[model samples]
Target: MASRTAIKRLTVEYKRLQTQPPPYIVAKPLESNLFEWHYILTGPPDSPYEGGEYHGRIVFPNTYPYAPPAIRMITPSGRFATDTRLCLSMSDFHPDSWNPMWSVPTILTGLLSFMLEDTQTTGSIVTTAAQKRQYS
Candidate 1:
């Protein structure tokens, strides 16, 4: 179970993001569960992911806020591994590198940008990087 502090922090941060969406991103809870959220992020127009409205989920742990949340794209945005949970700087993906100072909005931006890179690493998801750069 999350401590009261974690819960309160998440509640406030979540509401803040919901009330003021960053021009390109919109996220909301998938259900009243509160632990699971669904987001639709539009990629930067000039970029390959541009014109794409990516769908994904963010799962907060019991220690959320104190610990980063896990983010995974459900639509296979061509950046992350297919159906594979992403390995992010935040989230359980790479806890060692996550910064607690990060808010929900910051995390979302980082996640989207990070995936835009061609990591050139095996474990990383190699999107249809070759499919002619089309947006979804």
Candidate 2:
């Protein structure tokens, strides 16, 4: 079960996102579960993912913001395996580095940045720019 503090924090964050949304990304909690958020990222300009609209979800731990979230890209971006948990600093892969101060926007932005990188991580895929464009 999620703590009251986690629920409250997530509620505030959700409100802030709805009113003062970030660029290239839109996210919202699932109607039935505050711990699960769905997001759509407009691929950053001038990158291999440009013009792509990638969809994904984040599942926050009961302790949230303190424990980091599990993120998975559902889109076939050619840079990441669809439906696989990404290994990132702000993700479950690096709990020790997670900052409780980080917000939902931070995670989305970080994911976008990571998507543009060519470095290969456990859940990441290596593909040509052409292949990425094709997937886009």
Candidate 3:
């Protein structure tokens, strides 16, 4: 059972996405359970992820807003591990590291920006030099 606040938050987020969608963010639940959201995000133009749309999922705990949700990419983004959980500074990767002030919009914005980076991890696809050329 979800608390009123959590339900309201989900509703508000859902409505906001419907009107003015994000340039690189499209999210939906894995099932009828609105708490789990799967997303597809495109990298900003001219970045390593340029012209690419990556897929991931955000699992919001029933006690969400109080605790940051867990985020993982189901599809291969080449930026993050595919299927394996990530260790983002703000993710439940380290629940104690979460910040209360952070919101969905902020997280989404960070995600859009982060994919441009080539992290020091295996299974991450380095955007080809040719791809970077068209990023202009």
Number of the top lDDT candidate: 2
Off by over 4 Å in 3: 119-136
In candidate 1, the residue pairs with backbone N, CA or C atoms under 3 Å apart (3 or more residues apart, or in different chains) clash, namely 78-127
lDDT of 2 by residue, 1-136 (tens): 7898899999999999999888899999999999999999887788877889989999999998678999999988898899999999899999999999999988898888888888788789989999998877
At residue 135, what lDDT does model 3 achieve? Answer: 35
Looking at model 1, residue 47 earns an lDDT score of 77
Arranged by TM-score, best first: 2, 1, 3
Candidate 3 lDDT, 1-136, residue by residue in tens = 7877777787787778768677778876656888888787876665666667778888888877778788887766556667766666557777888886776666776766666665654334566556543432
Q: Where does the lowest 10-residue lDDT sum fall in candidate 1?
A: 120-129
Instruction: For residues 1-136, write the lDDT of model 1, one tens digit per residue.
Output: 6578777777787799878877678887666767788888887877777777888888888787667787777776667655456777776777888788887788788777776777653336555655515545
Candidate 1 residue spans exceeding 4 A from truth: 120-123, 127-132
lDDT, each prediction: 0.73, 0.90, 0.70
